[model samples]
Target: MTIANWCVLAACLLPTATVGLAKLASARLPSGGGRYNNKQPREWAAGLSGWQARANAAQMNGFESLPLFIAAVVLAQQAHADQARVDLLALGFIGLRLAYIGLYLANVDALRTVVWFAGVVVAIALLAMG
Candidate 1:
């Protein structure tokens, strides 16, 4: 498989990784009552705050961003865009996404937004490459 194909898989997994942070934060709460409730995950997530809240928000954003990124990558491949450039941009998107999640968890809203914008740009660039 192409590197970009692997990146598409990674992008698909990103939200799960982000939400895992929220779950980890929740699990580490002082109270034993903070255990993850798989029965009602959204309700459990709704009560998250601080970095946990940001993690959940990042998870949502990851999901929201997937359609565009996936479509762009697939379309780019179908259109026979340069494979090396597509793979590089795919890596860029993943890198920016990782940075965005880190910045969100660190409570650096402004910089996180900038990274998020850069990721979007990368996705758009992938689409344009098609």
Candidate 2:
């Protein structure tokens, strides 16, 4: 598979990893006070606070971003855009997304927004490259 294809996979997995971080946090809680609820996972996630809440939000954002990124990459490839450039842009998107997630978890809202915008721009660039 091409590097862009791998990036697509990475983008797809990012949300799961982010949500896992939240679940991991719940595992650290005492006496099951805020433990993950398998039967009502959405409710459990909705009740999260602090860093855990931020992690869940990041996960949702990751999912929200995936469609555009995936389409851009696929369209770029199908249109026979330069492979190296496509790969570079895909890598950049992944990097920016990782930074955004970290910033969200760290409670750095301003920087996170900036990074999120950067990632979206990169994905759009990929689309235009096609």
Candidate 3:
């Protein structure tokens, strides 16, 4: 597969990693009762206050972002766009998404939103690359 195609695959996998990080954040928290049940966990996580909360938000956003990116990459490939350009934009999208996760975890609110929008724009750029 092309580097961009590989990147698209990586992008799809990133959200699972992000969710693991979020779960790690929560697991680090002192459990008041018992070990994490790992069932209906959102309710458990909803009680998270600080870093855990932010991590949860980032995890959710990662899930929200994945499909758009996947669609963009697939559509671009189907449309037979320039491969190098798609690769560059795919890499850029991955970078922006990583930055978005960092920004979310750091509680950089305004900048996080900006990064999220930037990711959206990059996804659109990928679609336009088609």
Candidate 4:
């Protein structure tokens, strides 16, 4: 696969990883545990506060983004977009996503939204290119 395609895959995986990160971070506390629970962890996650809460939000956003990003990728591929441009946009989206996650964790709400919108714009640009 092209780097852009690989980036799409990475973008797909990022949310799962973010959830794992939140779980790990949460586990550090008395309430959260490092062990993976058979029980739906969402309940435990819902009760989180502070950075864990932010991490959870990031995780949620990650999931929320995947569908749109994947659809854009599929459209771009099907429409035979300029592969080079698509790849660049995909990479840019990943970079923006990383920044968004960091900003979310850091509680930089305003800039986080900007970064989030920037990523979405990049996704839209990919669609436009397609």
Candidate 5:
């Protein structure tokens, strides 16, 4: 498979991993089926906390990056760009995104921003290479 293809696969998997983390975090929160209620039951596991937001941010970041990744891959394939570089960029982008997620979960906003920008730069580089 092409490097672009591998990146796409990794991108897809990242969300699942984030979701698993979110679910685990959510499980710690109080269980409730009520809508628009913000009460921490005795069993509540700190819902809507920063950690949850970070997981959500990671999911959102994944979604935002997906289209760009796809576009880069398609453009690279069409333009016959260097597969190795594209693949390397793709891996780099994924790694940066993962780091961004970690930083976000840890509430490290500045570092998360840096990682987010790095991912964006990687995508732009891939697009430019195309």
Candidate 6:
């Protein structure tokens, strides 16, 4: 596979890793429904609740972004678009997604949202370029 394809695959795996980490952390939390609901759990629950939204968001973003990533590759291949641009955009999307996940996990909403939007914009740009 191409570098772009590899980057896309890595991007796809990132959310899954986030969810697994969140769940592992959640499993260590003290038992309480409220603990799960809140963003900051007092203990290990903090990892669970604090990262839950971010993990979910990452998963959502992954689902939303995958199609565009794939489309970019296909279009670049079929339409004879610039391979370097496609690869760079794919890498940028992955980087933004990783940043989004980290910021989300840290409970940095504003910055995380910005990074998320950046990824979305990258994906949209790729699709439009098609």
CA lDDT, every model vs. true structure:
0.91, 0.93, 0.81, 0.82, 0.74, 0.72
**Alpha-carbon deviation at 35 in model 2, angstroms:** 0.6
Deviation in angstroms for 69 in model 1?
0.5
Q: RMSD to the native, candidate 4?
A: 2.1
Candidate maximizing TM-score: 2
lDDT (tens digit, per residue) of candidate 3 on 69-129: 9899989988999988898999999999899888877889899889889989999999887
User: What tens digits encode model 4's per-residue C-alpha lDDT throughout 11-128?
Assistant: 9888878767767755555533433343867677766777768887898899899888888887998899888888888999999999998898889999999999999998888887
lDDT of 3 at 37: 43
Runs in model 1 deviating more than 4 A are 28-32
TM-score leaderboard ranking: 2, 1, 4, 3, 5, 6
Q: After superposition, how far is residue 97 of candidate 1 from its true place, in Å?
A: 0.3
In candidate 3, stretches whose alpha carbon ends up further than 4 angstroms from where it belongs are 26-35
C-alpha TM-score for every candidate? 0.94, 0.96, 0.87, 0.88, 0.80, 0.74
Among all candidates shown, the one with the greatest lDDT: 2
Candidate 6 RMSD computed on C-alpha atoms after optimal superposition onto the true structure? 5.5
Candidate 3 local lDDT, residue 126: 92
Write model 5 residue lDDT over 1-130, tens digit each, in one string. Answer: 9867888898878876874676665554454632123354322323445676567567767888788877877797779898888888888888898888788788899888888888888888988988
lDDT of 6 by residue, 1-130 (tens): 7777898788778867876666665565566643343445344333444467567666666777777777766776567667788788888988898888788778888988889789888877776667
lDDT of 1 by residue, 48-112 (tens): 77888888999999999999999999999999999999999999999999999899889999988
lDDT of 4 at 101: 88
Off by over 4 Å in 5: 28-30, 33-47
Clashes of 4: 0
> Candidate 2, residues 29-91: lDDT per residue as tens digits?
774588997888988988899998999999999999999999999999999999999999999
